[model samples]
Target chain A: EPEVTQTPSHQVTQMGQEVILRCVPISNHLYFYWYRQILGQKVEFLVSFYNNEISEKSEIFDDQFSVERPDGSNFTLKIRSTKLEDSAMYFCASTSTGGDYGYTFGSGTRLTVV
Target chain B: KDQVFQPSTVASSEGAVVEIFCNHSVSNAYNFFWYLHFPGCAPRLLVKGSKPSQQGRYNMTYERFSSSLLILQVREADAAVYYCACGAAGNKLTFGGGTRVLVKP
Candidate 1:
């Protein structure tokens, strides 16, 4: 089956640094999302992207965070200034329909802000 | 506030069935989804419930504010963290704390 692909399976960065996580959603999928799971915690929605703009975002998605579908195929989440609390496994997901159809998820980028 | 609740862990023997129960506090959310995740792997979609019930080896029962995931004849490979999610609309999902299943052979 086709899959969502994410780069940098693991990353360690200093607190206060900028980080950009990259993802390539399924070719035919339309909705793109970024979610984060803090270790041993529930998965939290960060942002949803559709038609090259953000559709909705959680409160956790603040000024420090932004998402872009730069090239129609690659979706990215950029954290302008990371903090220690930013450490988590960031998952990229896509769906042809909406959540009722479930989503295809990427292996995830584990970001560890030190 | 919307909250999804699930047990922390469940242990079962191989060939036994495992049922993970989930409940949510979002009264307006009717869409339920189940996902399975192995450590360091992507979360995989196991079932989707747009309505009340789904049929398959991995069955799902979705009520307006609660859902259950039934894994039939589970094997060792079925050991993983299972997450229940709900959304008021159709886009963003709010997930439960996840139930970790342990299958013994």
Candidate 2:
């Protein structure tokens, strides 16, 4: 089956640097999202993208965070300034819609900030 | 506060079948969800929203499918640990810390 794909499964960056996590959602899906999970925590929603704009975003996604569909196939999350707390597993997901229908998630991109 | 409480915290770094047990005190029930997560990996959606005791036996037409209550029959591929979760009336899904299941060789 066709699944959502992400690039650079693991990444390590120095604190205060920038990091970009990328994802390619299922082709037919219409909604996109980003979530994070600390090593010992449940996954938390970061932001939801729709109609080429962000429809929803969590508090964790503050001034340092930004997302864009730079092109038709790539959805990206950019962290302007990485912090120790920013270290976590970032996952990308897509769904036809979010109400009743389900979502498909990518294997995830591990972001490590030193 | 309103949140997703996943219990049974961390387990072995390798193969595990996490139970991902959860419950809710919400006066009005809405939806349920389950997701699997690997160490240093992203959380994957394994099961979607379900009503209390409403998830039917997992009957699969494909031989590779499972048919038990919440992943009824288990397999090695199903060995990624499991979690049980519930979504509130809103789209928020509160996850159980999850149960870790290991498959011995």
Candidate 3:
């Protein structure tokens, strides 16, 4: 089956540094999303992208965070200034349709800020 | 606030049937989905139920503001963390605290 691919399975960065996470959604998918999960916590929605713009974002998606569909296939989430609290497993997901359909999630990127 | 409730852990011997429950409180929930996650891996969609009936190995029944995932004839590979998520109107999902299933050989 087709899948969403995320680069850098694990990343360690210093606090206050900028980090960019990349994802390549399924070719036919129209909606893309970014979610994060802190250790032993529930998954939290960060942002959703459709038609090259942000459709909706959670409160956790603040000024420090930004998402861009840089190209036809690549979606990226950039954190301008990372903090210790930013450490989490970032997941990229895509869906061919809207609600009621299953979403495909990529193996997450483990972001660890020191 | 919207919330999902589930047991933190469950254990069963291989070949036993396991039923995992996901009770949610979200007035805006339009759909329910179940996902499986292995340690250090991403979550995979196991099944989704918009109504009370859907086709898949994961059976979902929504009643009285709660849903359940019934894993029939469980195997060792079925051991993973299962999460129940509610899909709101805008396609956003609020996930439940996961249930960890350990299958003994």
Q: DockQ for all models, in order?
A: 0.74, 0.35, 0.68
Ranking by DockQ: 1, 3, 2
lDDT value, candidate 2, whole model? 0.66
The docking quality of candidate 3, as DockQ, is 0.68
TM-score for each candidate, following the candidate numbering: 0.95, 0.77, 0.94
Return the lDDT, model 3, position A15.
Answer: 100
Model 3 Cα lDDT, one tens digit per residue, A27-67: 99998899999998888989988888999999999999999
Q: How far in Å is the alpha carbon of A24 misplaced in model 1?
A: 0.3
* Candidate 2 structure, TM-score to reference: 0.77
Ranking by TM-score: 1, 3, 2
Our model 3 lands, by Cα RMSD against the true structure, at 1.5
Local distance difference test, candidate 3? 0.87
Pairs that clash in candidate 3: none
Docking class of 1: medium
Q: What does the lDDT read for residue B100 in candidate 2? A: 64
Model 2 per-residue lDDT tens digits across residues A58-104: 88999999999998889999999999999998988887766354567
Q: Report how far off residue A69 is in candidate 2 (Å).
A: 1.0
- Model 1 chain B worst lDDT run, 10 consecutive residues: B48-57
At residue B91, candidate 3 shows an lDDT of: 74
Q: In candidate 1, list every pair of residues with a backbone clash.
A: none
